[model samples]
Target: MKIRSVVLAAGLIGFSAVASASSFVGTTNAIGSILANTANALGDSTASTFGSDKVVLQAREDAASFVGSNGDLRGVNLEAALGHIRHQMPELQASDMQLAEAILAL
Candidate 1:
């Protein structure tokens, strides 16, 4: 009977350790998911704040495509995008090169 009790206690402790490990894994996964979600939310908010207008969005797309294809900022698409941005936002203080670089950065 004493041997049986010892065996049972050992079995229970082993099960408890497994359960604790499983719980720790679950908690870590949940925290990782939360952090990823928070980062995504922040990224989306920053993008919206930076280029909320259709013109800016189109320009960024154009510049990105231009840069991707030509590997430089001398494409017609980039030029057109810069022109459109300057036309739309006359108050923008950035130079044409600066605007093109910003669009590429986006």
Candidate 2:
């Protein structure tokens, strides 16, 4: 009877440890997921804001495609896009390169 009690106690202790470890792993995964989701949301918001302008939206596809194909920002499409952005949004404070890069990113 004493040996049976000892075996039962040991089994219960082992089960408890396993359960605790599983719970900890679950909590950690949940926190990681939350952090990943938050970062993705923030990135999406910034991208949307940057691309929201009609001028930027109009130029984005061409500029991005040119940059992707040419592997640089020295293309007619990119230049035209930059010029259009400048002419349309003169009040914008960003430089030509910055605008080109932004267009490429979009």
Candidate 3:
């Protein structure tokens, strides 16, 4: 087969595989709710800092909710996304709503 034909065939196979798979889905929650929950977890009303709680909360079954494979987006994306927010807009935290949409779209 010609190189072009082989590439076309592979593309078709990949497209079919992707189309056959179920789309991952999820919902969203308020960022305040999430942060408040984190605060509660830390046992400090005005701890005013995020660290282990953030990581723990992210992996939490309820906090940073999502669907599909456990490593679907990988920890890297989550970290990178948070970093982007820090440099681009510290005030803007990734809301569950946004995360849900992103998860579902994935």
Candidate 4:
């Protein structure tokens, strides 16, 4: 009886994790789309505007990547993803550490 109860509890926890991840995936997708749309509306198609857009796009990409790949959100595991993100924008990644830290905290 104890074994059966433990199995049932584990199954319930698994189901809840799956449901929440599914919901967060949808939210991630929507946020990426909105960021792209905002970038398009910046009213300046010059190099600077394009550069600004690049930063926004990279952030969106990183957030989406995190949500999709983070089945396990333990601190050490996230370091690799953080490195992957730094490859996209070396300056931003080097200068600003808060973004990735905040993402992991979430």
Number of backbone collisions per candidate = 0, 0, 0, 0
**Global Cα lDDT for candidate 2:** 0.63
Q: List residue ranges in candidate 2 displaced over 4 A.
A: 47-106
What's the lDDT of the predicted structure labeled candidate 1?
A: 0.62
Best by TM-score: 1
- For all candidates in order, the CA lDDT equals 0.62, 0.63, 0.44, 0.49
Q: What TM-score goes with each of the models?
A: 0.43, 0.43, 0.23, 0.40
**Which whole-number lDDT from 0 to 100 does residue 11 have in model 3?**
100
Question: Per-residue lDDT for 1-106 in model 4, tens only?
Answer: 9999999999999999999999999999998775454434331322242234434434444544554554333244345444544565455422123333334233
Give the alpha carbon lDDT tens digit for every residue of 1-106 in model 1: 9999999999999999999999999999997685455435533533454466555566666655554554454556567766766676677666554555466444
lDDT of 3 at 60: 36
Which digits, one per residue and each the tens of the lDDT, describe model 2 over residues 39-84?
3553354356556666556766665565455444455655666676
Which candidate number has the best lDDT? 2
Q: What is the C-alpha RMSD of each candidate to the true structure, in Å?
A: 11.5, 11.0, 14.8, 11.7
lDDT score at residue 8, model 1, on the 0-100 scale: 100
Comparing 2 with 4 on TM-score, the higher-scoring candidate is 2
List the candidate 1 regions with Cα displacement exceeding 4 Å.
47-106
Cα deviation of 56, candidate 2, in Å: 23
Worst 10 residues of 1 by lDDT: 38-47
